[model samples]
Target chain A: MESTRPKWPWIVASALILVWTIFPILWIVMLSFKRPGEVGNQKGFLPKHWTWDNYRTVFRTDLFTAALVNSIGISMIATFAGVVFATLVAYAIARLEFPGKKLILSFALAIAMFPVVSLVGPLFDLWRDLGLYDTWPGLIIPYISFALPLAIWTLSAFFREIPWEMEQAAQVDGATSWQAFRKVIVPLAAPGVFTAAILTFFFCWNDFVFGISLTSSDRARPVPAALAFFTGASQFEQPTTAICAAAVVVTVPVVVIVLAFQRRIVAGLTSGAVKG
Target chain B: MAAITMKNIVKRYGDGFPAVNDVSLDVRDGEFMILVGPSGCGKSTLLRMIVGLEDITSGEMLIGERIVNRIAPRERNLSMVFQNYALYPHLTVYENIAFPLRLAKRPDEEVRRRVTETAGLLELTEHLDRKPSNLSGGQRQRVAMGRAIVRQADAFLFDEPLSNLDAKLRGQMRTEISRLQRRLGVTTVYVTHDQTEAMTLGDRVAVLRKGVLQQVGSPRELYEQPVNLFVAGFIGSPSMNFLPASVDGTSLSTPLGRFEMPGEQAAAAVGDRGVVLVGVRPEHFEDASLVSEDKRARGSIVQVPVDVTEWLGNELYAYVPYEAPADLAAQLRELSRELDSDQLRTQAVVSLDASSLIAEGTEAALWIDTSRIHLFDPATGENLTRDEDHAARLTRAAEPSRAAQRSTQQPTEP
Candidate 1:
């Protein structure tokens, strides 16, 4: 029945969704190329005069440059720590039969669903008291905590898909339990690990609430938070074009990462581990 | 290679259910031993216990001289081939076979030398660089065996390793595994539910029933002198047919007809019981027209209407349905279910020469070999006609040849 249906209706619906989601990104790219004074003219969707001057201004500013460095450092550190901890926790959840396993899983899920806005006020006061305000650790801690539940959930699911016999076979082949996990189970769970790491990195990179409320200066301010503090070259002009350029810069890495690992993120790595 | 001995090995799960209940067996050095039974019979559980994957609840498991009940699987040094051929998908065939050696921290040159030799023995040289996903089921199974053989472990355990292959490949791999086991001369304990594999590959076979060992013997002994009804029914294909019979002096009254047994045979079969079950192999019944007069004198003849006949070129099968008593019919049904067969009715399947003039819905004269028939006490399911002396002699005869093979191959062992 599906094969007999006309193809154009599906094609038309897909094109509509594509444009609805992609238009804002295309508009931002166009706005980034427009002249600084041209945003408020309201003449057309495309720029009347194309220029690289806004991009140059974005790079020349000390605030945006330092925030970019902070964003990369914090996101990378948080992703690494989150994935390492999640792998161990998820393996325990998937393979071991311990008491309180269900409680731990539910608690992690409740924490994931907890509102970020509610914690921002308490965390801000706590960071200040601990002398962690306006520091990289201030933002990194929350990013890792938030990223962990998601990473654990994804990794545990992948670990469950692996056949138990693979590890048993390895153990019978003379591998210690640790070696069985590191050499056999870890390689089998690589796709899940990669997917979890990418998700955690994105979560840390795109967070706004903690990035904005936790830090007061460029010392630990990420790009998403720094964008709100941008100003024009002088009092008469607006910073819309320069902000658009900075948005494009941060968005590039996310796009490249998804594109590069699209296969690994989606492929089921345990396909040939056992007969299906 | 070393002998593996299980002294009353028992495995109980957390729920306090004994999955393997007091199974004690001896796997001699450089011998191929098979554990066979229907599903859920604890054959695989026993194999796992031998390899230290499942902890023994109470018993001693010894590989060579060490009591290994508390030893880890890696420390026990026995490799296993899983039913699904659990090859590491991420590794090449070469690396997959070399995994154990690498885990042992072997040097690069030795790992290379041993893996190449094992791959060559398994005929996996051309697939050295290919991942397991790219290989066929048979190739993957060979890679799994290569991995087990490369370790030079104390023994090898196989848990239905060829169950996943297609029928033709299964036959080929069966012979290959048999040949490999013979060449390596490693003590092996293979678990399978398939009786044909049990009959063909093992130097000795052990049959289990619901976590209890029923009988362990040479396949010929299990066939000719089964200790009980379960062993008789489980060992044969187109298995032995059971018919309820009532004994009167030297004659037996069955659903088919009355047959006279010799005096000595009748005394052994009629042990304090008026009613007994007679077990007859399918091939023991022959078409009356095809039998010689002298041979016919040694057996009884019965005339029955054949309900169905199937000709398989070389032989013919004639199904003769009969009216069994209600209680005996239910008993046979339960036995059939336990044997993994669904026999819907009480019928005798008689195998005859293909040239016999037997057709559906026709009365045919079938000769039953009275000398070969077994009588069982229906209440206890015990074989009244079992000859223990003969069974022991059969097993004893097989020992010397096995010892000869081991001694001849000793010089080749490194």
Candidate 2:
């Protein structure tokens, strides 16, 4: 069902995606299992012994403990809240006839288009002035702000494919509009929801640039901040093994989530895509 | 079971053009009604309106006598089967059928019984554990039907349910759906562009064109007495033959053949604007030899060149050359390619009664059942057979008056 193109340009492009996208992730994963002393000393494709001592050290640190909890809690909360809110807006935007929809969608696209990192200084200042700095709510608020637009766009495209008749059928079956949304549209929109959740989690989890700038305390830092803690240039050499161990801890849970849901996520993402 | 009513329903998209105009029809309780038209003719939109899928821009919708214009589809107590089936691709057939019930918190045992019964009816019992993607096209369609049937709604709305199937499968599913509807006896509204489905499945077919309702009647009523040219040409397979003709005393002067215009149609053709259109059915044209001996009894006979031929085992249709009058000839020439349509060009279809079939390119005398001829005002496109004097009086303004009118007529055999 697929054609094999022998053109050099496209073959090079495929190799580029494999190298830049896949190889770096695989290398990072391999580096995660290396010993604290041996890590960054030399690069290798595989680890010898693959000792768990670095993992134990990461677990023992207050920053690692707090950061892991904060990252998981904030990502889950944002993903859940973003998905719920986005599904509702998606249904209305796709199916119902309402004015200003075009303007609102354009506003969403603008939100996605605007550089998220540019807002960190203002957000940090705002949160501190509001007496909300170094808090879970402070981190979550920004996380949702960044993740919501994409969630809504993905879910809305999926929602548009659900025939209005299905909702009509639900309404005629003694279900209210809200009931139809909950029962029919929600289930039918699950693939989109899964994709949105995965994307939201990854976006929030992998955000080092904003995480570093927004929080300065152990109480509020996520894993990305904890990983950055070891990067000092003044010779108090950061334990590469402990950092790799933390990275492994942070990346594995999401990798599992994505692997479990790869089929649905891929299908939803590529539904109207052009294949190579 | 409940009868559905539309009181001048209209649907206007935000873009401002009305997708459905003020079209209204009575869908009888326990009857299978069909809304049919060409693409973009608003047939699907009309069905959606009754289901409350699309809001009524103006006018009222009543399910059995209760106005549902403001009611949500779920609250209206109807179930619809979409064209694509809309079966949850992830759920097994049993779960798909059980979905609405489960949402209502029906007991598991009751859900099981209903699902089993529906599965048995649709012949999907063996594949209850299979997901939709795992099922074949016909099986998926049945799963869709099974989902609709399990709900026990007051009416079932089907939106081109069989359009995805190939030709043979479409015919097979068409019969299966019609039978299923009859057995279930729930009021149903089926929409399709295929006239065969409309004529075969509907208790009364409502023909629509560009958002306007042309006519709604029993298949025979629409075929024999269509209200306008659109209905005349749209109601049948291969369609009715239409040619330009003029009123000349008791007869119509047509280039294809002269016709004895019925009195109701004659008066419509009289005086002032005299130009009109003539219509005759393909099957109604018999071999002149097949006609009864009397002149009036045998009716008007015309000569046509059998331009093409098709043989379908037991049934045969002939496409033949038809001459047009000067004005019509000019219109026919511009549209000649259409008149001698690629579908039935080089011929005017004449149905063979499994007898000696007509040969191609041969001249033959064809007789028309004069009683079955239809006329239309070329200017307004209204059917002349609908007595002008009785036009407004023939239709009723209320339920009781219509019911009284129905009670007075002889009951038709099912």
TM-score of chain A of each: 0.95, 0.86
Q: Model 1 over residues B1-414: C-alpha lDDT tens digits?
A: 999999998889999998989989999998899999999999999999899888889989999999998999999989899998889988999999999999999999999999999998899999999999999999999999999999888899999999999999999999989878877889999999998899988889999998999999998899999988999999988899999998887788998888975458657667568899999999999999999999999999998889999999999999999988899889999998999997999999889999998989999889999999998888888888888999999988988876676566554646
**Model 2, which residues run further than 4 Å from truth?**
A1-56, A231-241, A272-276, B15-18, B257-273, B288-297, B313-316, B322-347, B352-359, B369-371, B385-414
Model 1: number of backbone collisions: 0
| Candidate 2, RMSD to the unseen true structure | 5.8
At residue B396, what lDDT does model 1 achieve? 89
DockQ of 2: 0.30
Give the range of the ten consecutive residues with the poorest summed lDDT in model 1 chain B: B405-414
lDDT of 2 by residue, B1-414 (tens): 799999898889989999889988888897778898777889898988888777799998999879998886667778888887777665788988888888778999999999998999889889999978788888988988888889778999999999988999999999888777766678999999887898777777888888988888766567766788777777787877777777776788776667777565455545455677777788877777666688437478887777777888877787776655566555434333432233322225677555645777788777777776777777567876755334333322233443444344433445
Candidate 1 docking quality: incorrect, acceptable, medium or high: medium
Which residue segments of model 1 deviate by more than 4 Å? A1-4, A268-276, B262-266, B401-414
- Model-by-model lDDT, in order? 0.90, 0.77
Listed in order, each prediction's TM-score against the native is 0.96, 0.82
| A35-68: candidate 1 lDDT, tens digit per residue | 8877876667899889888889999999999999
